[model samples]
Target: MPTKKELLTNPIQHIDIKQHNVVPLVDAMANMAYSSRDLNRAAKIYEMMLLDKDCGVILCLAGSLISAGLKQIFVDLIRNNMVDAIVSTGANIVDQDFFEALGFKHWIASEEYKYGAHDADLRDLAIDRIYDTFIDEDELRICDDTTKIIADSLEPRAYSSREFIHAMGAYLVKNGKTPANGGADSIVLAAYEKNVPIFCPAFSDCSAGFGLVAHQHHRSAAGKPMVAIDSAKDFYELTKIKLENPVTGLLMVGGGVPKNFAQDIVVAAEVLLGDDADVAMHKYAIQITVADSRDGALSGSTLKEASSWGKVDLAWEQMVYAEATMALPLITGYAFHKEAHAARTGKNFATMLEPVTA
Candidate 1:
């Protein structure tokens, strides 16, 4: 058998806690056998990509990030020109609106609240709040009025999430529907200003619900469909945009629809590239999730699976097993700081999209 000295003599090929002062949370991550080093490495790789001009487009898949209070992080990315496109959940959009609309708060359940729960058997760690104060029957009516105003103002074609939200916000402002003090102006305003595209496959989760409710009322009153737009064509248009670009980076905040939808695109690109494609089309990838991977669920699957399918760059797949709220800020902050630093130092940065053609 090989001696311990022989094994010790081998060059270290991975990051070890002894070599660096990792964040305490990251240490906890390592202890759980998660890839903390991989996340750091991926951050470094992303920094390198941001420096590359040809990198062109950056895609972020955000799920429930707004509820996690990480909307600012995404907004920061857009402000710093780190992301050009986004695929996200409608619930998050709604949560942002809820937070902005009423100065709503996210709260942890007190012991009393937990003890008095009807579903005592369930492990209830979720944050809770009473929306009893902000329930406005007129809110749905306003949403309906806003939707009609937008349909009359803009072309009848389907719009990206960013576009949709902006139109609604503008209508609200024009009609003097003041959101509660300190409320967010919706993600639509941010998207509009930055010219970034935000797509929400499931739109009924938040304010969209109010919009739908309004639409139903309008249809009954006017004998016509109010929100009669089709999403199939929108999907087709998004697909065409991705194909024309032919390269992307995926930053998945959570699992579920957003994760699968973004990954599926990478799979399609891989198939198009054929067997000998050396340079990955989906170049960089990162995921922060709480799901357990033991069941072979999509949420828990390691980046290695994605690499095998050409959905991520083997060298840059970073998986961090932490809350998106905790990890995304750090990663996004680092990316933004690096970009600002590069701009100050006059250092040229570009994204690498060259396929290693054998």
Candidate 2:
């Protein structure tokens, strides 16, 4: 058996969207057919979303994108004001993004090890695999412990995932785990600095969950209070952004809770606004995914289908049935290089909703 050091030598280098100007390439694809055409349209709609001053763009991230080397794209999105808010899986935010912020790295797994063929060997070596990526189990435990430390430092109360994540941003800043401090740039740090809110509806499903579990267990045994995550608060806070902004857009990568959570905010705003039919569904939307709609799953559900539920508007919605890795960079790159965000000033919705959330 190879040593753990040998197995994890080559770190996964994040793809920097800024390095490659894909504007001309994406624009060229506009004249092509099939998924290429869909991608072009999606990219155009994203540009429209950015140009619309009244529209707030919410990025919904699912799947294991950060580990797949898309972290820089998201960080760039936050920095450039292209994305106003984010809704994502806990694994992306906690296990992946925040994990890297702690100075750990995801390694590249050899193709030969992808299909469970070496999973047992990986486990025995204290390694975890995410398709083509590898993470150190020991380092992940450190991430878990760091969460517990943050939890321990917090007052006993129920916090929305947004709040907890915000605290994480604060932690990063205080401990010099941010780019400004010579550390790596991270989604959490960028969102914090930009006043962009990030929500993880299923916040307890990742490494942070393990940390919280340990925290609660320790606190309970000591007859002391402990911190908790309030998922409803996540829903309420996100819904508030929709109600206040009114005009919204979605750029969804893959799907699951983040996708559904972002879409449901429209209906949620309607309900909160006393069933205001004119409250407006998401004005523009784009989803990129490899899942099949035939599965009847939320991930595969068409944007047109969402209109029936009064979530997305069919007119400006497009479902690019493609993998996120393939579609995201093109769409975002087109918008970036074409200067779509030139006229955009992020809504700073996190600041807008701060008082209520705090």
Candidate 3:
């Protein structure tokens, strides 16, 4: 049997979209058929989103993207002003991104291990697997503890996921867990510096949940107040963005909560602002996923279906049935190489919502 150390020898290195200019390749795909053409259209729409100064681009993430080596791609999007806001699964923001910010890593499982050939041995070794990626369960406990420490340091009140993630960024800076301090750059750090708000609607579903659970249990035992996640507040704050910025676009990877949450914001705006609100649906939308709509799954639901709900506009929407790891780099890299972001400035939407949140 291979040792845990030997099994986890190779860490998954994130792909930097800056390194490879996929402009020509993606442009070539414009003439192709099937998902390739859809991807090309999606890339062009994203560029158009960037070029339109009035449009606020929201990047919705789901699945295990960060663990699958797509962390830097999101960081770059925030840095380059390509993404105005982020909606993601809790695992992407906590277990994967913030875990790395704490100086840990996700490893690529060997071919043998990927087939569940050694899962029993892995559990005994304190290794957790996410598909073909491996994480040190011991190190993850430290991440959970760190979140608890951050929670312990905060005022006992309900906080939106955005607010808590902002504090996580503050913790990173205060503890010198940032690139300037010789640590790795991360999604939270980059989003924080860029004034981008990140919302995980299901906030307590990841490592942070364990931390919060511990914090709450300890505080309850001591007869003191403890912090809690306000999911409704998360919904309200994000809807506030839609009402404040009438023109918006969505670039979603995978589906589920992040996708549905982002899309529902349009309807939310209508409900909050009333019939006189005059809010418009998202101007452009693109989704990358391998899920089939035939299953009646939310992740597989097409943008056209969203239009029926008045959530997304159908004029400039395309669905590329490809896995995120394959489609995101090509779409985002093409936009980067074409210099789409150069013509625009980041909305810093988080700053705009500060007074309301405060």
TM-score of 3: 0.98
TM-score on alpha carbons, each prediction: 0.67, 0.98, 0.98
Expressed as tens digits, the lDDT of each residue in 1-358 for candidate 2 is 7889998999988888888899888889889999999999999999999988899999999999999999999999999999999999999999999999999999998889888898888989999999988999999999999999999988899998998999999999989997777799999999999999999999999999999999999999999999999999899999989888899999999999999999998888878768536788899999999999998999999999999998988889999999888889999988998898987787888886653232
Candidate 3 regions with alpha-carbon error over 4 angstroms: 355-358
- Model 1 error, position 151 (Å): 5.9
* Per-residue lDDT of 356 in model 1: 11
In the range 1-358, model 1's lDDT, one tens digit per residue, is: 2222221232212111122333444324434543556556555656666765445344555554454455555655665577766667765655444334333433333233435442222213222222211122333344444445565565534444445655554554554444344344445445545555566666655566566556557666887634434454335434544565655667777777667666666555445566564434466677888888899888878777877765666766677887765566556555555552254221111111111110
Ranking by lDDT: 3, 2, 1
Off by over 4 Å in 1: 1-35, 56-63, 98-163, 169-186, 267-280, 340-358
What value does the lDDT take at residue 86 in candidate 1? 67
How badly does each model clash, as a count of residue pairs? 8, 0, 0
Off by over 4 Å in 2: 355-358
- Clash pairs detected, candidate 3: none
Rate residue 301 of model 2 by lDDT. 91
